[model samples]
Target chain A: MAAVLPPQAAPHEFLRARTRWHPLEIVFWLSTLLPFVVVPEYLQLASQIAIAALFAISLDLILGYAGIVSIGHAAYFGLGAYTAGILSKHGIGEPVVLLVLGAIVAGVVGYASSFIIARFRHLALIMITLGICLMFYEAANLAGWLTGGADGLQGIKIGPLAGTFKFDLYGKTAYSYSLIVLFLCFLLARRLTHSPFGLSLRGIRENAVRMPAIGAPSDAHIRKVYTIAAAIAGIAGAVLAQTTSTVSLEVLGFQRSADVLVMLIMGGAGKLYGGILGSIVYMVARDQFSGINPQYWYFWIGLMMVLVVMYLPNGLLGGLEKLTARWRRSPT
Target chain B: MKAFSLCLGGLLAAMFAASGALAQQAVKLGLILPYSGQFADTATQMDNAIKLYVKQHGDSAGGRKIEIIRKDSGGIAPDVAKRLAQELVVRDRVDVLTGLILTPNALAVGDVSAEAKKFTVIMNAATSIITTKSPYMARTSVTTPMLNESLGMWAAKTGVKRVFTMVSDFGPAHDAEEGFIRAFKEAGGQVVGSVRFPVANPDFAAFVQRAKDSNPDGIYAWVPGGVQPAAIGKALSERGIDTKKFRVMGQGELTSDEALQSLGENALGIITVFHYDHNLGNKLNRAFVQAYNADYKRNPDLFSIGGWDGMHLIYEVLKKTGGKTDGEAMIGAAKGMKWESPRGPMMIDPQTRDVVQDVYIRRVERVGGKLVNVDFDKVRNVKDPVKARMK
Candidate 1:
């Protein structure tokens, strides 16, 4: 079918900007370098943080940019994890191929589910997405013959990255692999957010009715973003599966989705760096606090979250950005 | 006053100097438990028991100061438990890894311990497959079938020809129920019917009613943890099915203090078979019970017994190795080792790394106006039946 241009106002300068790389992005990436120098033993934890960051960023693509609220994002994550795990166990042991396959499966699943997801808003939207995730969780549980049920899909052995650089006990390979993937995905997300499609999605997010009036296919854009986001989340799950060498039903759990949401909100949703920073802060804090006192650690985390929500509603990153902006504007 | 203060400072300095000369390497033991969720109560009990063991030994084992580090599993998520295990191994550099409540957490940590080659002693996890999963893993805990092996055979031998089974639908529950039914059937009994309910389900009236309608001579029930076991016992009593026509029997934890306290008089005369009983009439058990009660102000349950024995086993291993923390050396030293546990004589099977111990059959009866397990018979030298069946 032939496409028609809409009678709309001139695009904003922010929309016209092709690159979303801020100068601070280098500092963000550099900060990750310190873990290798200071605490090389914590590369496993760093890898986990990287994977979670990727998952949160995937959510940021749809939830932050397209204004869709999903409570079941782990559906894609678990899907990717199980797919990679099952395939690797069945002799498809190549890590790169397993990751790509995971993304493909999760993307297809997300695209199919997004049709119904895009038609609703608010509570209905949340419930439907949650229902889909719950269904997957139950399916994984009941298909004990294949998924291993509560015991988890065990004995998943992945071949080395590109047949070199094997995953080690210290998790050097896993950390590097996940960081590379996250950066690549972040770059794609950055470019997408500044592209015409990303702007239309943002416009739809701000006013879906106005978007349709301006002749933009809001539903199509939302579905496309959701599918892409699912693929990225799947890649995150692939990282987790390859790194951990096991996948369980907890990967698809409500807690996984909720934890990522908390990470994104804490980092600052809608911004690219928000997910990365939020994951680092939340995961590292958990590792440290939980180590200090396992019994009462959650209480401390809960208190910090409460204080953050109260004083910094835009999250730590967003709050810091506002503060810095204000300071710079006032010539201080 | 200045002279007295100077004397006290001299005393402190001498003590520090003396301690510095005698200081040996600290043995860092990391205990991972579900300290915040469904298994939290069990975790606390086990933690206290381990602490008691350390306190009794003056906080050192084989001349090395025993330092304990704890990590919470949150009871449900296995991946989080795995990461924590990794942290304990890589960051904390723990000499030994122990303590997890659920089977999944054990398996998750088992993978980490296997890869990292960390000495792991499972305290309370009852899954049969954990030992086989990791070379570094050895369990002081009993498997799921240990409790039911004697009870089922005895029920059939006692002329209970037809049986109904009800248990929570899960991995360990299935193991327990299968153990009972297999033994009962082997002893010439028929399982007339079976029903399963969720572990978290509080109301068991419907399931109880269904079992009653099946008209079996006895019901072989197993519900571990939570209030579900109490609810099931209450439903049975309220339905008047305990009035001679039907027999109710289960694993010992069904009539645990938490369950018995809630089930009250309704739990009276319920038969069960477990590895550990508070009223074991042994010197070690009597001392353990007295000390545990004095310290925690509560009765020691199965999980506490597991933890107490786990510490004793670790202490013995430390003695054998002269405080070396090599995983392979510890595992080798643990195999075929016997100990006079609070429960009775227990030995770690050389091949399976699972404990071979006697199972006790008990009936819940009022002792000092409180429900208590009274020992009746013992199933001696019970090994890992899962591995045994394969052989």
Candidate 2:
């Protein structure tokens, strides 16, 4: 199709068209900022939601778009956390510098691991990722001198955001900082997903056997996406550690990996907004349910998951798409 | 319809204003605990004690009306605990923070308390360095070194010379193991062998076999007060390392009533040390146990005392400050405060703001047709050795 295109044709014009911002997306982003005005007391929770959304997006990149189903995605997230936490503990308190360092370290690890990860699929891939996650968890557990083990990485003194906005008792600075990072990362993810590289990942997901024949190099695409996904997850972890100023073993626990996967699946996969939307629902529901009945909050969460899966297998975004399908542009 | 709706909205606004005014003067204490998940029973025991204390002593402490607010952390989630503390401070305007059940969660809230200057009381978290994290913090719970080190010193002092130590691989267990080892070595006792089993459920047969193979006169083991203790007890008996032949000793929880139930007669000779036990028959403790059992229909564990004594400390501080709930007043009044608790005489050490109390060495014995920790020996005025060295 590209070879037969006329001189006046723009390259990947359909991709650009799909990437164009929906009016609702603009409204959604603006509404995120509304918590600052309307519910400033929940700034800490809002910030946590932002971090979770970023993490879910990272998972969606590989699992949703690249056809990789990883339950141990928390490996990269925890890696990023420990990286930032260790740096802060040692007096490298600058948040941005630690964040970038966290990304680089996790991205490198992800790139190396992807060599093995790219070869496997389905059950083997799930077990391999879970095994890797357990290794990191155990490593953190054993290296109590460095990682602080189950006691958590303590004495982490994260500096003020941009050397100006101190994280106050009200969490004004932390929420804003997380929101900014989340926004920038969201933009990068959106741009990445709409590119020819992202299209190759989709093709690989849909038809791995045919994608290699079409010169897409399925392994390379999968590996690249996995690396980026890990890097993004690292950023999310860094954000969490920086904002909270602590990292416990739970960051790398099996529960964390499982929860993120659940959030992504509940939000829907493949489409870009599914992960973010799912995080919002899941996090908010958790906060509310736990508030109402902390002892049995998981029961409510489980019920919601069952309901979402049963009624809307495609997730909240999938349901929304169906409702608004008639008004939107049809896929070419 | 519009007039009726307007009337209903006005009534609602008036009710909100009225309730807000009523809640304003009440002294709010935010209780954060793992009220769900694996630690649910721990939370329940402590919470039940808190309720018992409130029932015995009227809710009002100092000059103000008391209000209790509960937040369930669910587990060792430091991030969630910190957020709950923040919410307690900013949203609920709580005057004090309490009921922190995990060390990491306590440390996390310590940051919040230091920043917010809210007087925080450690209820059950026992890590020694935790109180050092916040100036406004004081601990009612006993530290690992306080109990374990004393137990080790006594063991060496009495008769146990050669020992093998086996404990769970975690911070508290490591702390306990180190204190026991150091104290025993200082007293000229030789440690035959030591190993940290996996933090979670370890294969008891293998671990018990390894300990037995060491061929030591004494086997010191430390695990949390849970199902693991019973399993370890069963494993030890199965391996023929009975308390009768080889001296078995550890933290008090090893021979808890539930562990006793499972171990039956095997739990009889096991020796352990701790600050509080439901079976301690002191006058105050008898009263407390009677009341607790009457109300909750169960024996209050070590956690129950921490919660009970913590509430008592709050009441005393409130009375001292004449109901001043500010950080400075509450913490200042709390320091060096001596009180008679069900645990016996306990003082909030003025220097470290950690608990100083009597640690009793008890033998689990059959009394009145049930297993009970019979207090046979004691170490008095014991400070958390780790923090005692600091100042």
Candidate 3:
């Protein structure tokens, strides 16, 4: 039997030391690397997964970490994508410049919109976001000359990343670029989660009244987080537009927003790594099921969603974490 | 010196007369289509076909230059179409507008185009009601009821007595399915069951299962675009459903050689009604098929051909009217205009302003691992058919 030790048994006996690297973490890292070892086509798929994961992760930051639910997150994503497409079409093709511009545009929109959105509860916020997205969709269709209207903005020529790395169909460069961006964003989010501000956010989520009572401006913090999340989402959109070299009105559609929410919920919203894992699982399942039977694949997906909601409320990643915890606690 | 001055004056008079005889100003044409979202693929094909036609025929009508500016409606969604139409007419300041692929889009744009007194030529949309409802709106494609009625008559003649039907839950598909049901009944065929599926649904298993449970004498389906055929064909094959027991029909890019290859033998024996087929034995069609195949390395589908024909028809009208951009002159010239197209000779109805052309009933067959037209029969020249049913 292990001896019961005090919390400060040693100089390094803190929670950080106790959180040793688990086998699952090693497996997760290995699995993510697995796509790179496969063929070029698989690598392209992994790149898409990475971009999609980043988009979902941005949503997870606000929805899970900050306890804010957004139904119109695609607004920022689509806005960022279209901003890049519109700019490149009009002769601004530098990748770094476009990324910065996209983020700035999306962040400004988010900051402006958050003034109204941060005041609302879950349902009202969702509806308002949806309304804004629909408005943008209509506006895009109306401005045919600028946005390519309904046919979408096509034939977008993004010159090169930093005037060096060119995007190719094989997706080698795109994958690495997207992976790096995702990694950085993930690190920033993780750092935020562990910071004093992040703890205050958790405090706000736990009890809004108590956080303000302790002199924390919870609303301002939530709005700030929301704007940052939007900027991250915008970057993901820029990455997608750069890779695909085409932007359609569907990017701003309600379905896209819903899909991101579904991805976050399926992955384990509160966990940072869950977003990437969930996107991979969802996309792979979709590709496999659709190839097998195009008509009935949705039924299977729906069934799975129902099962997850009923049994594993915390999502796949959370469920796995729980299983691991239980295993560690039980006698071998 | 005085004689030379007279000669110069006479030459100037003649030059003025010639200039008066030939209209030489650029005519602005606005194109409104669902260019993005789910309808983006179809819109792209339509735009490509139109551009190709303009490139080959030159953008001059009569002697005047014609400029085509495109606007995207995003989809057949009504509100979006209305807003887009307003922007096209008010902002773009185009003389003539064309290209609406879905019924709702056509109707929405039609209203705005009429309100703005713009001459709108619908290239791909086929809602007959639009012409009867809005005088300013004229169509280049076949109407829903007319196409479905012909299909019903053909099915009756082919000894198909009972059928199961399904359509996507969109306005155009629903309208076409309803017309098919009504006409099939009138043509001595019984509709065993009918089902509607959501638009943009990727999976077809539940719908297919429902269809199998019905088990009618034949199946009549009206699904559009590339995805439907691929999904439907795969579902049917997995369910062990026989093609002979079904007669699928729809307006789709699925009839293309590439799409058929994807569907494989499952696409065989499927009967479809179309206005154009590359296999038709006509000089114009043969030339078009040759040129199109040479360029794209694939057979041009009906939508592409129809889009090409629409532009060609407009070009002919412009040439005939001496490059007039005025609504009255263009409309007058378009009436009863006859021209050789990829689908052979097509005549615009003087009364309804709809193109009356030959329609064909063809059965799909896999030859040398490629889907090609096997048995085709000329059904009818639904020329100037009463705009009554469209209302």
Candidate 4:
């Protein structure tokens, strides 16, 4: 099979035949390694990036891959946080179990709502999702007996991971825990994207009518993906709750959902890896800008957003990728 | 068969009579609070305090069982207060209603409660104007204007000359800034400048810079919540602004140990005005602080204390009324009623229905690795006759 192929094909064949590393691939791996050694602060920033990446990735799956626009993704995030909090308050200390239960609850709620949500498009979808989020916020307030109400769920003691791994104050445990969860989720997302199921989702995104005609189960596929994305978003929320140990009603606010959407679009949707990069840049920019001018930081962020949307339409990563492609074509 | 029918009739009549007696013996209390959204923390604190009171009192006040029902206001959103009040009255049919965290929320609920002829208790909100506008509303919490005016008076008395004020765009904060400026100016102090920022402002550098450039004798701020003090203090410190150069005064948990840890020593020497502080040397205050710290591992802020006191005050009135749920009876009982509070003797004013309480002027100090109230002085016993600047 190798002999019959061209020289380029031969190289591909050898790489497919054996695990041979590309120079670019090696450099990418090394760059990840370099951060741990040279820029330790980046690791702390990277942990936040990972959590935000998870959030954006969840949104991307629903928005980019499933062709669904959710303006209330924070509903699931907030729900997950409250669930973890409520559960912990009731003496359930296992972090993994709490995380799982939180995700599952959000997923179930998402699945139930997907029927109503899947029928709508654009503005209607946005409004309906926002309505649902507001409903949750109101309900959380009303159900003060369970939710601890506006005072928030305080004095939450997350004892340990599986009753063993204690959470430390300096964010060491939190960073590692978030990193591990993010890595696993990333791998899972990669596998899903490459799978036949993900390709079916892509087909639905391209042409919903065509996919249904071709026996692709478009509505069911969309619903399933939406539910999965919500579950992932719930994981992000659970992680946040574990890290902060205090979940406020602001988690379900429209602003948080908007932030995730912005991050997804800013990172270049559909590529999957863009979410991580976007979250990192966005958070770093926010931190730096706020540090520079606390009161006028929003102005700088708003300005940057305008520039990104107007000039780099596909987002920072997409623009860089395009630049890299051009550079390669022109031999630098 | 006739004898059997008569016995059945007698039994049915007895059951009905028993239920009626039980219903008559119980007093129903309603609490409307923002149990969700941003104000949830305050609501929960109120809820917990009420619950603790109820548990201690055995759900009975003055020989009658007490039935407490609470509804969430959501926030100071349009129509939410009315809806919550309607639910409390129409569904739960509570006799006495209480708990409003924001000024607008208190006003909204106060109207509804008055219309329904229910005794309303304004808990955690510091809207001084509400009591003046509505005779039915009674506030257990300190008023924003009163607190601000006190700060201004204190500053003036301490010989502060030119003052710059910064505050959130909210009504309470706006009122605080305005009231302080007015009082400070009245006390022969010159107003340098004033700026209002949005509540969700994450950065305070511009405001700090503006204040610095103005070169005021003191800077007065009215920013609340846990985040504001830290953010403002850190920014001020980073800008090399000294607290000694200006008198920083406001309502916040920012000067607390938890906030100081995040803000560092920048919070030190900051003067703050409030009705209650953990350092107050009253029996109730000492017990409350000790119990709360033992329970929550954190010092109770004014919000928590206010919540606890609001519940206690309501309970005291209910107990005095002999389980009468009538609005008139409860109102009469509440007026001129004195209670031993965390801030000492608290009396409900007969006319305005506002609490006549002592206000404290505290300077923030780092004690045992925590920012706490040190060098506190009881500046004045604020009474209702002072007349809140509402109109």
Ranking by DockQ: 2, 1, 3, 4
Local distance difference test values of all predictions, in order: 0.85, 0.89, 0.73, 0.72
Q: Can you write out model 4's per-residue Cα lDDT over B232-265, one digit (the tens) per residue?
A: 9887887778875567877544466567677677
Q: Chain B, TM-score, each prediction? A: 0.89, 0.91, 0.82, 0.87
Candidate 4 per-residue lDDT, tens place, A188-259, comes to: 776676566777888887888898888889889888998998898889988777764656566777878988
Can you write out model 1's per-residue Cα lDDT over A21-84, one digit (the tens) per residue? Answer: 4567777787877877788889988999999999999999998889899999999999999999
| All candidates: TM-score | 0.92, 0.93, 0.54, 0.53
Looking at model 3, give its docking quality level: incorrect
lDDT of 4 at B346: 83
Cα-lDDT of candidate 2: 0.89
lDDT of 3 by residue, B1-391 (tens): 3674586479658854765675564677877766655767677677777877877777777777888776656564443455445545544556787888866566556656655566778887776656653565566777766667777777877888878887876555766787777767888888888888866777888877787797776777766666777788888778878775566665434455566767777888777776777777778777777777676666666567768877876788777877655567777778888877777667778888887877777778866766776537766567533475444
Q: Candidate 2 lDDT, tens digit per residue, A225-306?
A: 9999999999999999999987999889888899889889999987768888898999899888888886788999999999
Deviation in Å, model 3, residue B137 alpha carbon: 2.4
Runs in model 4 lying further than 4 Å from the true structure: A1-332, B1-24, B132-134, B384-391
Which of the two candidates, 3 or 4, achieves a greater TM-score against the reference? 3
**lDDT at A96 for candidate 1?**
92
Give the residue spans of candidate 1 off by over 4 A: A1-20, B1-23, B200-206, B243-245
Off by over 4 Å in 2: A1-11, A326-332, B1-24, B200-215, B225-227
Residue A78 error, candidate 2, Å: 0.7
Candidate 2 has what TM-score?
A: 0.93
Best-fitting candidate, measured by DockQ?
2
